[model samples]
Target: MIIKRTIRPLFSVIFVFAVAAVTLFFRAIVSGAGRDPYPDQNPFIISQTKHIPSLFNATLLKFSDVDLADASLRQNVEQLVDGDFLSFRTNRQRSFLSAGRYRLDIGVRNVRGSAMDLRSPEFHQLRLDFRRVLKDWWRQRRFDSEVLSKSNLVNALKGVKYKSCAVVGNSGILLKSNRGEEIDRHDFVIRLNNARIGGYERFVGSKTSLSFMNSNILHLCSRRGGCFCHPYGEKVPIMMYMSQPIHFLDYAVCNSSYKAPLMVTDPPLDMLCMRIVKYYSVKRFLKETGKELESWSGLHGGTEFHYSSGMQAIMLALGVCDKVSIYGFGKSDTAKHHYHTNQKTELSLHDYQAEYDLYEDLVNNPQAIPFISDKFKFPAVVIHR
Candidate 1:
């Protein structure tokens, strides 16, 4: 009886220790401790989330009954229905605005319109074909004839290199810098997200050669009457990267009305930008925190994290410009988030500090940039305070 009692107590103690060890193991797995998070799939490869739908498939065919009955909404519906003609007229107006400017030899063709009326059978059929082309692009990332006809960005940038380019960001630090003339001196000036330039011309230059934007900006414009999205005048060429698949429909509708070049970033270039930014962000996270890679997504809003528009602009400038100068890409604790707005906090989705680090690397050590192919010859980069 004494031996049995002694053995029972020892067995109970061992069982308690085993339970504690299992609990710790499970906690480690849940917290992504002591493990590589993305072992099965290569983190470098672009992976599509199954939860996010590829297309929104918004209806553009007919107006709702409620819209027709309301006179106030009737005009907007009519604008949607007559988008093609309005777009043609807008294009003509933009052409007029661009008159006598030093136009590029790039083929900026006039959009041809049929004599058939908007409600006519032929016109509707043409619209259907255009919509199909947009859907195909979203699904396959193929540049069809319609896309080529509407956009001259590729042709304008092809084989021609700029001597110097300035990429301007919207950070409020620009208010402190009286570098407008300096910014305008570059051969080409690229601005981001339709930032205001009216009263702030002394800080941000009056000249804009190109406007790079996210698809969200265009989507917002698509909601307005006639899709009036010309904040930097109607003649400046626009290059935008798609942020949402639904914005493809926005492009399809608004692109018809744009006079100057309106183009989406090619899939290859978009993927390259994504990979480079991700690499920098991940590297920063690992170095600064000494944390496992698995914990990064949880802290950074998972798949929602994205590079800022300024980063993409810099990448494009690197490819096409001989020298790139960046301005207004920094943040200060006291400064507002944007010079043109009252917003003070940075967006949670973007890691501005990580992007600044990237800019620093680009300026000081171009060879050290990771994930870019060795074939790419990075141009000289300078960042201005």
Candidate 2:
């Protein structure tokens, strides 16, 4: 009886192993059949020339050589296990690459209006509408003629030429990441509002080239009864964006009280961000997913659409830096909202899912790497070089 029972259990184990082996064998056959024909041609690498150098000048795949958008989406869904989110990533990446190659020339006499410039006259005509938005923002700001003329909006980046940049978000996923050395090695580092590097420098890094914040945050951080009089460290430049008329008051305080250099985002630039959000809503969601975007006010419950400060930092980095690496941008179920604060925040105040989609898109970008992890993984995305 004992021998019979032992043999039965052994048979069960062997049967299970055989089934798994058969399954894997068929899976391998399917994958091999559908694999990319040109393994050496990577669409991720952005080059200016139409002719891609091959050992034999062989006909390699170009961005148009294959339906890359579909291929990337498939891979993202199979590997990341999120279909809709990966769809946004694939779409956004394609949109970015369609406009221009990955380099941003800081010293050029004139920067392109859109990172994705079009040679077609039709596109140029369409961009005039965007120009109107900028015009409206400029007229509304009503800056002192002298101040406006003397000040160069992007003068903070006048002498700066960064090969690499790290845009650090406030997400708690960075708590245990020992990536301080990796972050600091970059030529420039940017942080968002109220980002605390103290005591957590080993995890979040200590360098700050530029810091971005909106008016409401500035008011709270600088006011007499506010939580923090000076949240950011000295010598780090502040880039403040306008949200309300009250922001003007906060801007004044920051300029006067804070010894660090302060630059207000130009009306055109600020308006451009608004337009970008609108563009995403129209193209990314309504058309692709058949889903509509929901608007959320701040924690206080107001009535305007809000963009996360992390995304603002990312857009800014993409405009100036040659390559950008995003850290502490995504949140897992187990992680806290903010790394520095013990108190949890109401995430519903912003469109976090949509923003995460954008970050995922950037992660798949060849020039941009985003760090996302569930566990306390040391490095999130492996740098190929």
Candidate 3:
């Protein structure tokens, strides 16, 4: 009897230890490695509880009643498109006014003035993480002597004050719009992805002030082994935004090889753009902001976490230009992917809808000095001629 009791107690003790081990393992899995257990200890821009699925569902319920075809334009959008336009131009203004706040809160305005310092201490703090990655890439450069003499990227556009700027996208809608003359009239013209402008110049304009592209494009171009120069014309400057650390190598090489003026995006500004997208993603997809500006946009929410190149170019224009005009932005029923080629634009990759919303917001914002449509011409209907 005594032996049986002793054995039972020992078995019970072992069972207790086994249960504790299992509990600890599950807890670790849930919390993630090196993460604090308490919610208070982990602070984020948006609450963690506002999960993507819930946010998307809420967005749908809020805008279920709105008609996609004939909805009124949002208070922010100045231009009116026909109901037949490919994407719904409904006034789905987000409650979060992040665009203006981004410039004001993140000190994007500080980059202006005579001395545009890229290596300032304040600038460094904002892009510290990106700077670290860049430093690593710089160390791996084959020829360190090829480095730029000037630290700032703004030197490329020195003594240039853009009074009116036109940011042109590759959307096929430009082909039919016949807005090339108006686009060429702008003081400065910005294009994305080194888009083709040879024959399309009549539609896209011939003037090329600045072009924005990511490093992946440069790397791919270099790998393709083509003499793919002069996409932006003979001597136009380029702003290459680094998407990864390895991109710095391609950038350095391009700087050495290419005769045209080339510049890189400052890391702080890059991060600031990222945060602005995050803010919009939350406001449009997750929050209870019940503002219905579109009929079918919520379904695609939580997919695009990054801003489009066109949007980034527009933001850059806002920093430098007195007035900004966007051309060839939205999709249309008859329009192809691009005006230059037969290629199709992937919608899932970038948040085009959100970017479109911002365009409308810029129109409504009175404080903004830049007029989106100072003498803008909308597409005209043709009866016979």
Which one is best on lDDT?
1
Q: Considering summed lDDT, which 10 consecutive residues are worst modelled in model 3?
A: 376-385
The CA-based lDDT of model 3 is what?
0.52
- State the local distance difference test value for candidate 1: 0.66
TM per prediction: 0.64, 0.51, 0.53
Q: 319, model 3: CA deviation in Å?
A: 0.8
Q: Kindly report which residue pairs in candidate 2 clash with one another.
A: 99-116
- Most TM-score-accurate candidate: 1
Per-residue lDDT of 1-40 in model 3, one digit per residue for the tens?
9999999999999999999999999998876844533445
Q: 133-203 in candidate 2: lDDT tens per residue? A: 33444465432212212224335566444578888888888885788888889888888886778898899
**What TM-score does candidate 1 reach?**
0.64
Work out candidate 1's RMSD over C-alphas: 14.2
The TM-score of candidate 3 is: 0.53
Which of candidates 1 and 3 is the stronger one according to lDDT? 1
User: What local lDDT score does residue 344 receive in model 3, on the 0 to 100 scale?
Assistant: 76
lDDT of each: 0.66, 0.52, 0.52
State the displacement of the C-alpha of residue 190, model 3, in Å, after optimal TM-score superposition. Answer: 0.6
lDDT of 1 at 198: 97
